[model samples]
Target: MTVGQRSGPPIPLLGVEEEFLVVDTDRGEVVPEAATVVGRARPALGTRVGGEITKLQVETRTDPCQGVDDLHGQLVEGRAAVQAAALSAGLRVIASGSPVLGRAVPPPITEGPRQDRGTATFRGLHDELAICAVHVHVEQPDRDRAVLIGNHLRQHLPALLALTANSPYWPERDTGYASWRSVTWGRWPVAGPPPFLTSARKYDEHVDMLLDAGALVDQGTIFWDLRLSTNHPTLEVRVADVPLTAAESAALAALVRALVVVAGDAVDGGDEGPELVPELLRLAYWRAARDGMGGHGVDVTTGRLLPAAALAERLVALARPALDEAGDGERVEAWLGWLAADGDGATRQRAAAALRGRLTDVVDEIVAQTAPNVPMSEESTLA
Candidate 1:
């Protein structure tokens, strides 16, 4: 995988990891029943279903997929498996970025010795984390190239934020922001964009400093919007909130893998992009979180505000070549059209709240939307 000897075309194989909130139907709030929900689904979901740091949350991990269709189908099945399991437990799973209610309470953290130690060390910050996100992992050529991909990803981070903004309601109420999860996540000292580093050695050195300074617990806590994965040979993007629909999830996955290919090409060609200040990147992310696709976003190119929808289209254009290479261009375009018509989760949730005059209705709507299609005949196989 030498940079100079690169031949053929770039193929950034990728996969999706989605987290969901388990809610008590009677209470209309997230509940600490992930263990039950996950256990019941274990035989069906196998390794795909697991517990998150909190008992209110469960996550699904798909196998590394070489094509967008396989990745998309895996996500659909993962959601359905969890949805069916939750329903059997007299509950349901919602894909909102955070809890739907403004006055939602945090459930007890999941029972694990490691989680216990983290709670003891971080104190209240651990309690503040009831958020969930959609993480995408794209194959990398090598560790050094992975580090460069992180650098390449910074400019588009805000656009990523805008496309998948889902958390508008948090602990207090409609926070006037789209992705409250992003704001909540930023409270962590090391949880935003990665710093500028040219090589894997330098990136490792920076992470070591964060560990020594106690800014992070370990490599797992790097929490950068994008980073070289610790456990996999993929560069992972952790910036997006959990999108509600299969269309939205697949769109993000397609865009991310294409962007990785775009970056790999740039690195091989010896092209260097501008070094943006971390503060500016933070401001861009904040703007996207505040507006979703309902308003303006800070343009990463000129530091000026642009309509979020327009910027999102531009982002898709930038990655079109890579999307075409992966045979995902038509699908991504269809997703964009659907988003233009129906809006994102944040928009839909707010609309539901407004129409029914209660967040409870919003929760019900999310539940109904996430319902798995039962087999028409008992023998029908799922996708």
Candidate 2:
């Protein structure tokens, strides 16, 4: 197929997908109650939030938003609806990438055709693949631009991962790794930063190969860190774990919007960015998987070693222009400050668990973070 240049208004928009674990508030154990919550929230579905692969997972997508303020409102409203539904079902939602309950025997498949197929495919790959993630999708002008943006964005994946790391404990065990969700996702054949694509045509060719090999059903099945959306004119970043709070999730989405604007502009202007070798990108991804924000450092372009803090500083500097250009600099900076000070949700949850000697406290923290009006002390009753 002949590839054409992307065509549309250059306005960048943002959408978010957050997955949460359903747990009994008192027991702090996983419950197959997501359906109940989702059912209760049906009147708000599509208008606010939606369901995901398992009975324990739910996802929220913001209405296409042009700025951080709109994004924030959508997130707050969506999460409120989900939390209310969960409360009505006598369940509390846990937002960590991997729940504290660990991997239980695969629950019976949820009711959708796509989810059923996804479950079957996942079961074929690993025995324990019950982790959750937050996928951020940013609209591009068209498919070609989406492909180009995905390619240029690959080098920065590690930086974004470091900032969003939230899954420290996995399977009820303290995994020293920062984001155990990365480890779980790595089990998939095509689940990391994608190899470079020279052009949109080449990307299509690669997708065709995967389909021919029976590795994927279609373009939607290509689960790379960056991929052209099969249904929308957007590039989706699927690297980060599900955040523990709606604020964190919104912050990540804002950053993604800024990154996409920068990359899309570079491609649109025919100024393909500084060539970042694939090997370096791969190594950087490994560093993100292993140390998260706590890791030493990453050379996004050269793949050389550096301290994680230093790398974060560099990324903030690099992204400042983009954030400013997109008029979201203030919000992005605020979010970064929160990440640096409190550490990511995973780090905070692990520390709280260690200090209190109970997973219930961690769950309570998540609940408090998710519901803005609910006081922390009241939320702690769950603990």
Candidate 3:
């Protein structure tokens, strides 16, 4: 393929999995209507739609696409289908870090003996989990490459979290953290940054340990923020919240695919990914979770703190070559600028709530932004 036409890593296809909360539009409260919404969406979405652990949320994933533009289209289609299906059920689908205007009570559990077992095992832990996120899956050349990509991805994953932070309000008040979902996910037994490991075998051993110790209910519960896809030949990035707009979601998916390409290239060139201390990684995660793109970010490379805008630009610079290979360098930069100026979903939510003096206004704004995206910034393109 020509330089301008080449896609990422020999046409490595990527897909997006997004989770959304089903809310009663009138009352602006999360409703346990996921099963019904997923059912209503079934004829169009088929198995693409699934219920989460709780019935207040539904998950939708796009089919793998080789092009970034194609991935964006797939994401938009998925969101539109979800919105239409949800509207038919007298509800609206809101894609936020957490459902802002509702209590934390567990909704109905999704039907399945396995799901039942999970709830039965974890009880309150599983029951209280209702956060939604957008997971990007980038095709891996093999298991070994997947592990290395996960390691390489570790340094940059917090930047991903910073850009997509959407859950600012939850648990009955403003949490003051950007991606409260990250905080909530940290409560899980096996979640957050991956440990330093060079090979896929070691990765498997770690997962096996978690399963044996019952820290994980099964392979699906591995929950390593970023992980090797258990079923597909892809490295899955699970750090981002379910963004409020199709554009934000598309921006994140493109960056993830670019990072996957960059990481794969590093592995091919026999480069070892960085080995930062887990404590540093934890602090970085905490900083990003607290501030989103509105505050300083921990520079994982040098341990120096940088403004979120500079850090975001550094990430784009690091991934520029891969982004060029994927034909999305310009698109990513444009959207990155937008995210910097506009702030993440969490910032937007807080602003809306502050203006309208009600959390329900924030919910309404989220639902509207989910469709026909309200531009986050006037400066969409960056030089």
Candidate 4:
């Protein structure tokens, strides 16, 4: 189970946490059924399956994995477990960033004092809080080094976001943007890319400032796209939307871990990394959210537009060394080839909607793709 720091070579270990939307197949929409699904899944998955901020969402976490193959198996198994639990309740799970179909109202938040406080403070913002994401945790024992590594990550966040843009719809219609989830998530006061921090001291200072100003509920409220994990000895990247399939999620995790390794190396060599203009970084994220891999993205370095796919390829090149170090180079390259041909989740979702001419078809596609190996009865697919 222990992944990082082995004798042969110190390959950085990584873990993935993926969130899913609980959907009612008959209604073809997300439903407030996470508690029920989690209850059923817990007996089988133990700590691996759990509820999230909204009752319509469930999440799975993998133990630290030494390589992508182990991580992919866990991701697939987690999806299968959640699917089994949802089917028991006549519900299905979809991996879309946003619900393809929903009622006019927001799904209810899970009841708790912490959840209640968030609801009270954020108010209407919580109405669209049913989005899900894929969070990758890479081993980083030194907090100061992790903070510096975050700076190295900021430039690449947009490319990462574009490749995993699964939420092209909201409620009942296409949102035009690929990752509506990113746009929706950025509404929070403390969300988006972390700012440049010189050291762990600066990182704590920033968190303390937010807490003192009530901009955050607690340290847990620091929802930066990348940050030093409060509960794990890892640097967490929360930038990607929940990918359409577990394979994509695993591939995304491998790329993230590679990038983190690259960043950590740069940090150790005393590379200050680029202190990008904050506006540029924000603009870059917006471009990725809007386009995914189907359009152009902003290159922070040159301040010029490039195809998002090109940017993503460049990112793979940047992480190639680290990828090879962990024996993931070929796997990551294969994923890139798959993405180039089949397109990202956003593209696939839109394609399904176009071909089937119904939002329900989009839901069905997500469900089937999420756990293709699991057999679903007629009732599980939308009629």
Output the number of the TM-score-best candidate.
4
Residue range 221-321, candidate 2, lDDT tens digits:
78887787776666788899887777778778877876777677788788655567767776777778778776675787665798777777776676676
TM-score of 3: 0.93
* Candidate order, lDDT descending: 4, 3, 1, 2
- Taking the tens digit of each residue's C-alpha lDDT, what string does model 3 give over 217-256? 7888888889988888888999999999887788788888
Candidate 4 or 1, higher TM-score = 4
Q: Clashing residue pairs, candidate 1?
A: none
CA-lDDT, candidates in order: 0.81, 0.73, 0.82, 0.88
User: Between prediction 2 and prediction 4, which has the larger TM-score?
Assistant: 4
TM-score result, candidate 1: 0.93
TM-score against truth, every candidate: 0.93, 0.90, 0.93, 0.97
Superposed Cα deviation of residue 136, candidate 1 (Å): 0.2
Off by over 4 Å in 3: 1-11, 373-383
What is the C-alpha lDDT profile of model 4 across 40-158, one tens digit per residue? 99988899999999998999999888778999999999999999988888899989888889862577888999988888778898899889999999988888888888999999999
